[model samples]
Target: MRIRVGKHGNSLGFVIPASVVRERGLEVGQEYELQLTSSGGLELLPVNQVIWKPDLSIDELLAGLPQEKLVYEDVPEYVPMGKELDW
Candidate 1:
């Protein structure tokens, strides 16, 4: 499909049709790697096959971290002062 490259802020961009986006399950904030093919074509690849979603659990998020660098520290309880809203 022919798409027009138009000015986006200070950069140029093209719009991906909604149909294509839905078919590919693309997310608005998902990261991708852009590559230039030898035949002068553009290719986009997801940085990770599994894109992070807001509903992911804390354990799921931490699973991506290296086990060697995992650290836990006890945080001191804070006393609210000056009409601070405490939950």
Candidate 2:
């Protein structure tokens, strides 16, 4: 585990042994969450999901940003074409 921290441009980075990386099936560009433990240990864990990021809203989605977007995007199937609902 004990890998030395190296300089990565303006950021600091470290190298994991190929054996460890290969065993874990980790890729070079794969996302990971780094944490500092109270016990003075650093943990690099694979990110299952982005924890720090907020869920994207409809307005935020690029597809929904166009002028042809609607508040209710889902097509209602209750009333069929050429037919009316009986009350």
Candidate 3:
């Protein structure tokens, strides 16, 4: 499909076809990130779907952290703020 870059308030924008938008679950005002590939191709991804570039290997990343981080924090003692319930 062909789309032309048009002017909008002195800025340029192109409209994604309705079929493409509906199929991709895209919505107005949603965020998108455009990636330029090494082979000179463009890739689009939702902000949440993008893999960050500062990729860290699991072994290297985890080696710095302590095992205690896996443990859940102890539950605190509960104090009544008001009159106790009759029940």
Q: Would you estimate the TM-scores of all the predictions?
A: 0.53, 0.47, 0.53
What are the Cα lDDT values of the candidates? 0.76, 0.71, 0.78
Sort the candidates on lDDT, descending order.
Answer: 3, 1, 2
Question: Across residues 1-87, which tens digit of lDDT does each residue of candidate 2 receive?
Answer: 577889999999877899988898888798888878789987777898535645876557766554664433345554443433332
Q: Which candidate gets the maximum lDDT versus the true structure?
A: 3
Q: How close is candidate 1 to the true structure, as a TM-score?
A: 0.53
Candidate 2, lDDT over the whole model: 0.71
Q: Candidate 1: worst 10 consecutive residues by lDDT? A: 69-78
Clashing pairs in 1: none
Can you tell me which runs of candidate 2 are displaced by over 4 Å? Answer: 49-87
lDDT of 1 by residue, 1-87 (tens): 788999999999999999989988888999987877799999787888544447888989888777565323222465556655442
Candidate 3 per-residue C-alpha lDDT over 1-87 given as tens digits, one digit per residue, 9 for 90 to 100: 888889999888888899999889987788999899999977878999998876778888888777664322333564544553332
